[model samples]
Target: MSEKFEIRREVVVPGTPEQIWAAISAETAGWMFPSPLEIPADGSRPDSPIIADWEPPRELAIHMQGPDGWFNNLEYVVEARDESTAVVRYVHAGVFAEDWDNQYDGASKHTDFYLHSLGQYVQYFAGRPVTYVSAEGPEASSAPEAMGALRGALGIASGATAGDTVTVDVPGIGTVEAIIDYIDDWFVGLRTENALLRFYGRNAFGGNVDAAHHLFAADADGDAATAAWQAWLSGVFA
Candidate 1:
């Protein structure tokens, strides 16, 4: 139980550090976590990762030992890279105390997917980004299978490449306009006129697929958009 490993990921998005900072406030927590995680009260770390260091327009680092009880400290670091991009690094350093194989593998894929989603979402924040809306579907499939369900539902070919302007007929949302911004076996990202969306194909506890939705929106369109998208996702993954 002494073996250790690290899962590192980084990305560059289109914006200055200052801009990226704004996009990642409490509002965008949904884009990362499965739910909106309220920022812990100042100087308090109760099971949740404490905001160890935050130098806005530059770096934000939080220190926490989670997936808790796993005996590991995870640090999520963000570094601004000028006005057109930024980098995020997720460091998971700890002993392979238990379930190392599964935990490490999932962490590797998920960290990559989340970083990409966050970067894309931040690219079009519009200065008025609203709270993120999130939802999850079933726990009965693999990540690839979960992603396959979404692609099949949207009539998107696995061959679809980024930068393609495609329109998908969402089950309950009518026609939705989107530009494919990122695609991989484990995740797919889309840019809509009013928001950024993601199909996260991650494995959950029960060998089920963690089908998730993350969106960046405005106060006026938040509820409606969340309803429409969550409805469509339910239909697709249900």
Candidate 2:
């Protein structure tokens, strides 16, 4: 049996409507996953049937319907709060099959972290080019202690909170001072001079942990970063 669910969240981003739209629509790699989307420029709708609505700088909606009567919809409404700020209302509605409770739980929590990262991107690194590198830890990361181990390896205290300054040593890379931009039971976000780093303790959701680096440095090397993080993750889970 399939069950329907809806998740709603509101976030205040430190960017204008235009900037927020660009970040969500085009520069998603900076905050979210790098799934490049081709939004229609003309008044016409995009070729993909998934796009239910497209009003740039204001509203964008996506609807995907499966043949088995299951569907998923994601909508974002961006409203100007001031000349340099905006409020975003996000809605994610979908249907889940088996283990729907766990699915819903994970999805809802993920929205919190992702949206926070979006706000961080708009506030700190708006309009900057990014090199995104991601790596997943070994199967041992499924253990409950994986998050603590990863944080320990990064030199971040278990009780660290946002706004605290700390120096992180990236194995195979070098040490860099950073501020804790966000932290929660399942996610940790770090902001450095040239990068935004995210660590996902996904073992709570029955998955291996993962790490991503969104490097905004002028001479960022995505390939090198990927290799270094992969090695680090392996070491942490080994």
Candidate 3:
């Protein structure tokens, strides 16, 4: 027998519903940091997609029908929270044939950070170029020890909260000061002077832990940004 499943991720982002919608609608690419946001839209889905529904500033749902008639879906929705903020939601749900557990584990972790970057795009780097670099870890997508090492490197405590100031002496990037954007159960995001950085700790399908990093720089200096993150991760997982 086959099983149906659903996973939902939501976050309150620092923008009006209209502003957030613009960024979300801008593109449907990797949703990671190093991916550029200025690619021209061709009115074509990144991959072959069967459209389900589209409501501006509200919802975008697509059907991912496989050869065997199974369903895999991706959806995004936003609700206005107030004049200056809104709630953004992403859901990747449906049926799968094999390795559903491990695949969804990666999806769950990836989706969380993806939304974090989207919220960041709307908040700080709208209309700017971003250099995004992502790495799958020694467990690359979810490791508590890695997160701990990162929190230490950034001078943030385990109980850090939003609004806390953080300063990390990044090896290739020099000293960077940022404010804690938010802290969640397995995720943390930072608003640096010139970039948005996020980390994720998640479980794989088999229940083993893994981790990942996504660093987005709006400074257009992709080489420097990538080098800094690559060096940083090498140290963290060394």
Candidate 4:
């Protein structure tokens, strides 16, 4: 008989089933881990003798080769009871062997990291509140100058003409439009409502702008906005 191990975890997220799926199914492997699996240099899913079985919002199964010529079976199942909670289970099976212990340890570590990271990612992408601060107060005499500095820090060109909107891209997330709403002496507030609106369109209008808004809010800080923008672009283009 094959040795079996199962790990189950429940994560409460402020997102829907669709949102969870999007994160897991993202093209970038690192979304689930700090270091992604190395595949072909051409970026193709390896032609390993692995098979996948997927049933959306429910289950996914894979049978693949393990280290030392071992064969392993892995299954991931999602059970959603409501809009805010889900139980995910990961199960592994393989034949027992002298090297089985090592394989199991490595697999367990990687899978655990993947699951934990995924949960955190889902929660984060599901909208989190963020705050912005300016060096000068709204009524300060140098507010406009401070706003210019803020915009420049965010990589918005100092000479960028008015009415120009820049696409802020994020990976595993999508692109958001950052309209230079207004640059005053006190602060610069980039309007991303349109970007949020556009995201809704691609996500089948999942009716979760609250989550998207949270994502933008968390990212709409100082130079961080530029990094967030680039991440969104990579996710979209990837």
Candidate 5:
């Protein structure tokens, strides 16, 4: 019989089903795995490198590049126990060389990370207290000041870059760095599936204001380099 592995985990996120669906469905190829192989987004290969069989809020099937030029398959089935809790089952199936027994452990570890990351993303987007910094003053001055403070306070640690992780301290939202997109003038754009939140300065002027504005759909949860600036401005100014 071919070797196989299965990993199961349940996560409770304080978001609507739509939000969870969007997060899970978003391209996670290079973001979710520790060393995810680069595959064409269109899955044009004769043997599709990455394929997703998606049924929103219910099931998702992923086929990724695997060892021996083979493909590893993962099926995620989501069952909503309530408005806030979701039971997720991940099943992995693939042919592996006998010497690669340890691959099972690696796969399991990757699954754990995936579930944890998804939970955090969902919770944060659901308006969980990820960070909250209070700025006392007029919106103009306080906003910019708060933005600068957040940027400085989140000092540059080693290896902090786009797609990496870092946290910012807000007065209400605790310190959390699911992923660092980039630091803008007023706010940083934190990558999310549904939107990119622009974290700006609290006291800054028209372009410099401390706030989180929703941008647009993100290609990956860890992609901080590209943002829908035009769409974001339209939404914000509108």
Candidate 6:
């Protein structure tokens, strides 16, 4: 049997409604994943989807259904606070095939991180192109000390919190002075001069550790970044 889940989060950021809409729509790669948010040009359902709502600079919603009554939906309602700020109300609803509790917990927490990243992108790096590099650590990453080792490698102390400044020696990438943008037991976010670095302690959720880099430099090289990070992760978990 499948289980249903819905995650809602609201964020107030320094951007107009139009800007927020663009960030979530056309410029999603700046903060979220690399896939484009495609809306069908014909106004018809394709891939079992319906564009339930489409009001530019205000609201957008999409719903998709699977053959076995499984459905996933995304909705964003942007409200302008003034000329320079807006509030984004987002909802992510879906069904999971199994492991209902664990799935819901991970998905809900992931929403928080993604929304925080969205605010960061809108505030600082809005509309910039990004080269996203993701790497999975070795099997030993599931060990409890895996994330701690990576943090120690970056010179972050055990009790570090957001907003602390530190210089990071990024392996094969170069050294950078960064701010701890976000941190929790299962995640770490670093904001450098030109990139957002994210570390996922997925062992807390039954997976290996993962690292993702969102490089916003004009000359970013995704291939080299991925290769370097993968090697670093392998060494860390080995």
- After superposition on all C-alphas, the RMSD of every candidate to the true structure, in Å, is 4.3, 1.8, 4.2, 16.9, 14.9, 2.7
Q: On a 0 to 100 scale, what is the lDDT of residue 163 in model 3? A: 92
How many clashing pairs per prediction, in order? Answer: 5, 0, 14, 12, 28, 0
List candidate 5 stretches off by more than 4 Å.
27-52, 63-71, 126-238
Per-residue CA lDDT of model 3 for 35-60, tens digit only, reads 23242365333342356766767876
Alpha-carbon shift of residue 89 in model 2 (angstroms)? 0.3
- Which candidate, 2 or 4, would have the higher TM-score against the true structure? 2
Candidate 1 minimal-lDDT segment of 10 residues: 204-213
Which of the two candidates, 2 or 5, achieves a greater lDDT against the reference? Answer: 2
Task: Indicate the residue-level lDDT of 94 in model 1.
Answer: 64
Is 4 or 6 the stronger prediction by lDDT? 6
- Ten contiguous residues with the weakest lDDT in model 6: 40-49
Which ten residues in a row are the worst by lDDT in model 2?
A: 36-45
Residue by residue across 69-100, what tens digits does model 5's lDDT show?
Answer: 66677777777768767666667777665535
How displaced is residue 97 in candidate 6, in Å?
Answer: 1.0
Per-residue accuracy of model 2 over 168-228 as CA lDDT, tens digit each: 6776678878899988788889999889999998898889899988999999888989999
Misplaced by over 4 Å in model 1 are 1-5, 24-27, 34-49, 65-83, 87-90, 94-97, 139-144, 203-207, 216-231
Residues forming the 10-long window of minimal summed lDDT in candidate 3: 203-212
TM-score of candidate 6 versus the correct structure, residues matched by position = 0.91
RMSD of candidate 6 to the truth, in angstroms, is: 2.7
Over 119-237, each residue of candidate 1 has an lDDT whose tens digit, in order, gives: 66666663554455555655434444676787777667768988877778855456878888878776777777766667766653224443344554443355665677667766675
Which regions of candidate 6 fall more than 4 Å away from where they truly are?
Answer: 36-50
Work out the TM-score per prediction.
0.74, 0.94, 0.73, 0.39, 0.42, 0.91
**Best prediction by lDDT:** 2
Better of 3 and 5 by TM-score: 3
Clashing residue pairs for model 1: 15-83, 15-84, 16-83, 139-208, 140-208
